[model samples]
Target chain A: MTPDAEQTGGIIEVRGLKTQFGDFVVHDGLDLTVREGEILGVVGGSGTGKSVLMRAIIGLKRPSAGEVTVFGQNFYEAGGEARLAIERRWGVLFQGGALFSSLTVAQNVMAPIREHLNVEGDLARDIAALKISMVGLAAEAGAKLPSELSGGMRKRAGLARALALDPELVFLDEPTAGLDPIGAARFDDLIVNLKESLGLTVFMVTHDLDTLHAACDRVAVLAEKRVIACGPLDEVRRADHPWIQEYFAGPRGRAALAAKAS
Target chain B: MADSPAYFDIDLDNGVLKLNAGGDWRARFLKAIDSRLRDFADDSVGRDLIIDMSKVEYLDTAGAMVLQRTFHACEQRSAASKFVGANEAQRSLLEQVEHHLAPCFVAPSRPNAFVAMLDRLGAGVSEAYFVAIAILSFIGEILVAIPRVLTRPARVRWTSTFHHMEEAGVDAMPIVGLMSFLIGAVIAFMGAKILQLFNAEILTVQLVGISVLREFGVLLAAILIAGRSGSAFTAQIGSMKIREEIDALRVLGLDPIEVLVLPRVFALVIMLPVLAFMSSMLGIIGGLIVAWTAMDIPPALFVSQFEEAIAMSNFWVGLIKAPFFAFVIAVIGCFQGMEVEGSAESLGQRTTLSVVQSLFLVILIDAFFAMFFLEIDF
Candidate 1:
């Protein structure tokens, strides 16, 4: 599929993408379109190629086949500066938060801004401090390094870093992986609030069923080396595929459904 | 998941044995033993009776021993028993246990040798390749850093550099000072002894100053740092890489080379010369102490003579090599640290490589400097 054909008011359009590691294929002819101002959740079992697909879209891992267009620009076709510019237009929240342990929470948030954006000195610090506070972390927490923060707090700090550039598009990889139920739910609420306030296009890879139910506009199930099901919650739940049926009908799935109902 | 045994039963009455096979050979053997014991209890037949053992599968020396012991007991009762199911493998195992038992056991065929050799060769090659990969990773790190010296300027992390130097230099001063003083004293004593033989004991100052400034000072300083600071850098960065902080930097659009590596390289480049100069002065002072006491040379006369003997060129040569040595240590340290993958084992391996490589490069570079200066008329 061509890059232009996939672009349809979507911040990211991945078409016929394939990623392989030696003989093992992670993504095979996968197509996905994440629209503007919507949280699109990519869900799959472990080793279902969810993270690889995300990495490919973000230009971290090069795909064996197909195109990824972000913000109407062909990601692979662009040169270094051009690609960097495209990257600046979007932020990534890596799995495990991936915070710089060496830098304080405030500095970690300020990194991208200082690198890509040309803000200087005290102004940069102020912007960083503000972003940290925006993510529900206190100004005092800004002085602490990532090692000092709790898991949920680290994720929040990572989210703050992602939001630093005021990017129209954001990608979160397993954002609620290790948090407790209450923490995960609170994170989901925070994500929803951020998306609504910033008018963001979110492409999130997650296993948290509650987050999918509460925050996602569309849930995409990756199976059979492709997105086998993609639609709103009700449509996806009705999918005839065995994996999807079992996945959403399982104990965890029921718990999430029950939580939503409550 | 229930813990249940599946097998046959064996009963023994008095001296008579009765065998009953179970679900499988292993289980059947267990049941057979039980049946034999029940039979021995119920019957008054002699314990020495021949029993068939041909139904057993994959027997070994242990199984044979069980049968052998039963046979021995039967013999004591004036009865004899033969094992009917002894396979060649079982016979071989029996023979292996005791050479004297070979006459009582059967034998098995041996496998081909070429296949075994081929398997061993393949395993050896793979292990060799793993080690080669590790070495290549170290080389790859150095290659990666060379480009950083030019392309990625921001990787020169000055903040970390100052922090490291404070630890590497300031914290290191006492030991370096003490060691340099001792080294100078030894040199002074050695020089005085040699000069006294020639009745030119006053030349001890010249010998001490020249040796300290020309080679000992810079080399000693570098060796100390390589053991202390260089290893520390490798461990710190290696641990960070293992923990994914480096990856975090890249994802955040920060170049690790600029942010982490550059400052270290910059700091070493700045600090090593100062360290070398200090080391040289300290080493000379140490030599002066011994020269004064051992040779009966006055402290004032020794100082003047030592200062006269050491040219500006001697000091410059030692000082100049400091920065280069520092660069070698820093680059090797950071490069090896960055090369670390996965675990603490990689950290250790890289740390050793850093020290060895840095020392080798330092000495090699020092040799070249020595040769270059030797060619000059200064």
Candidate 2:
């Protein structure tokens, strides 16, 4: 799997990954590669650790044994400016939106921009505004606190913040989990549109089958502490595995595929 | 990877300003690109501006955004502009940004100072009114429920009541005992020092006996409990409210006041009087210790002086106020918790308010009690 994942144009490579919590092991010998400018969706049964792999790559969780290379630099070994520089090139949208409850939506978006770049004040504000609008929120929503927004709007606001610095890569964790069907579909459209417009290489951990059908260029299936299948959704769907079989051919999965066809 | 520093070249040719932009125009390199583009925007006023991106090696949304903003500024200054020589990716980036340019954002206006002050004053007044109404209603609910439970005898939650009692009374014994002892000792020490001037050092026993039995014991216990158990009650109930457990109780056809507030109220009402009596005894013993150690009076002599100075009425007066103080502290804490809203911040704010209000009201009621006792001369 690592040999397959170690291809050219890979923006992120996770090799020989193992994640454990105290005595419980979450992942072992997991391998994944997110190609440049592709939306890679990672799916798994609950407790199979789709998010642990994302956390391992993003430097939030220290893997017990692994090397995560981001832009070809070993993420754990990088220090100071090198770490900051890599961080400057990517953004993460957490499951809860995780907006600073104290700041307005616009200020939350402007935060990363002001942190990493030097620019005129008005321009910085307008850039934040542009991002908020691009995510399909109203201009008035910019002044809102995160607690004031509904669940769907909060996720969109989080996405706007993720895109504020115009990073080459983005990580989304359960972006559509709580959204209504229409909101989730619109969110899928939004992410795909942003990827097309911004050429972002995305690593998404999600449970929504619709998101996978609509937004993902490739799908990776996690089971038994490793990726059991990884390729384009169709190719991955054809994998002769139990979880993949129940997932893509399951009733809800078939509904997702039908919706995509329609 | 080293980013090639982006640069721009501007030249006005035949009423057409040709701006040449080059190098890696990524997010980190856009600050310089934006400033130079701004300078070009002013020079190209009322002229056709052509931004040539053929020389640019790399481009991202940050760069495309700055360029799009420059186009917008140029349009505002009444200049016609067309972007040229951008490859498919860069063109798409610019188009996407240009198409979704946000509606003009006007920063929210600040309220006038006088208006803001009036607003706050009105809010505070209404809040105080609501709080008064809430406290009365909650007290009424408890009063109504008390008789209903008392009639059944088996309806009371004995376990919860005893738990609160243990937490608020039994657990608090050491601190209450120590505090009263120290207070009583200090009162006697001061009394002896001041009375020494009048050759009335023997009056120190009377001073400690009357003061500790009548006021300080009850007051100290009430304040300490208000700060400790009162705040804990608010935090507990407020967190339950935040987690929607209060609603869960209501959904199951149980009154929150009956389930959550009544046990705590009963525990405090039952325990405070006993604690106050114990505290009074400890305070007297502290006074006795100080009198014996400092003034060469024996414990038997101090007890004889204390028996003469302290009337049973002083002990009753102190013990009587305990139940009232306890009731207020418990009611205020539980009521503030029931008022909790969505966030953890709300839980925190309500907890602080519960403690402060409990302390304030306990002291306020004590003052009224003081005047009442003074009028009756008990």
Candidate 3:
């Protein structure tokens, strides 16, 4: 298929998605649309399949039934070349920073670039170094292996790799998990900064209220196997769902709100 | 004005050159773009330039950088050039490139293959030296602590020692017995065949008795233990190290050597000799059966021939080697376990190294003991 020259609306469109494992259902008839160049925050209770939804859209997990489209192409029905073309345009940051354990941070960032591009080795390394710094990591951090860095640094390394291809869209799964509050806030800042600078349409799965309040342009809450509420934070905050009520009106939510207001 | 089949279409009217660049301007098309850029650069010399980029469906870093280079080239050629038709997102990305383009270091070239091989060889030698030093220090620590624990017998971890004995000795009986029995039978069969050539078939019992009691029984049992329990020791301790459980022990002011290593080594030392003696007994039984069936030598005559031909000193020589082999195997296994680094890959590597190193050292020590005992006429 040719590039979608007339495409100008949603970057990702998921409709009637149903995913199940044995007798357990993860998502039931879920629908979501991610507008181009906006950070969409996905929040859910534990085991509500936030990560599963991210995996499904990224083509890592095949949904039991769904019409998943990206950039006006049927993602689940596209041919291998078309799929690869779509895959090349998007990047994913897995939950555990999933940076390959053996490769240095620079090499990790270069992996996708090398896979998708025809750049020389020197050019690739230079691009990787730029990405590492763009994610707020030092140039020296590029030479170190994933195991040599702290948890926050590993997350940054993963971010650099996600941005390696200069992808139009990025999927981040709990990017701020396992970090201190200050570190998490710093990471939130980095995400917003990169999104504006790189024109990335970010689909982020997170449980951190502070991240949704601080960074995300829109908040989508997953409950009862589908998105119960989705809109601007102010609109989603007034959601009548019990989970949303307890989540945003709870002490942690109140603290996050106060922090955001400040 | 319309969709074009080509990646780049240029229309030049008079001294004004308009270049239309569109489609997926990503990394995969860099080679094609390189030629196109060269043509654009050559044709646009001294001509006013206008680049239409709005129709570009995608533009990544490679595309932006190449476009930036072309823009610079036009400036160098004294041609006034302007970029037009970039949408909000494309403009933002180009602005990002413009702002964040800082000088970066190129990755250093890798060493040649021969230099890499030499580098690995050097690293291997240093690794071996460090391992030898670590093992020696470990042995010295255990030796020093043994006297203190021996005097205060109540302080020894008796329960852990017995637990390990069950794991290493009692649990290993079936395989050890089977292995030794098969070896003994094979030796008898070979010996009987050769002896029959000289009409000395009865001598097969003596051959089986001497070899089983003096070497094969202890050697086979030690090698099996090295493959079995040695790997387990490394895996258990290496996982503990990975999980920082060893650090937890240290933080609690407890010596991991005393708690972990001592019990495992003590258990191996105590059980190996017993296992060896059992293997020797089973081996003799196997040889007795083979001699009776294969050579018409009854159990009665075989026992009498065995009693007359093999001395108790042969048994002592094999038994004496058991504890030392056990010590070496245990120490090497535990030392490799302690050397495990942060990754699961390190744990797996160290486990394999533990088994291989222990088996090699066991055989090497056996060879040394064999020569020493031969010199002394034992």
Model 1's CAPRI class? incorrect
Candidate 1 vs candidate 3: which has greater lDDT? 3
Off by over 4 Å in 1: A1-7, B1-378
Model 2 residue A111 lDDT score: 87
lDDT of 3 by residue, B1-378 (tens): 553322777887576677788877665666555766866777666566777897788777666766655665554344447778988867766666654445343333579999999999999999889888888999999998888888999878999999999999999999999999989999999999999999999889889999999999999999999999999999988999999999999999988898889999999999999999989888888898889888889999999988898889999999999999899888888888888998999999999999999999999999999999989998
RMSD of each: 25.5, 2.8, 5.4
lDDT of 1 by residue, A85-134 (tens): 89877889998788887788878877886777555544456456556755
**Of 1 and 3, the candidate ranking higher by TM-score:** 3
True contacts kept of each: 0.00, 0.37, 0.23
Which of the CAPRI classes, incorrect, acceptable, medium or high, describes model 2?
Answer: medium
RMSD of 2: 2.8
User: Worst lDDT window (10 residues) for model 1 chain A?
Assistant: A1-10
TM-score between candidate 3 chain A and the true chain A: 0.95
- Please provide, for model 2 over B270-314, each residue's C-alpha lDDT reduced to its tens digit, 9 standing for 90 to 100: 988888888988998898899999988899988887788768898
lDDT of 3 at A202: 97
Q: Please rank every candidate by TM-score, starting with the best.
A: 2, 3, 1
Flag the better candidate by DockQ, 1 or 3.
Answer: 3
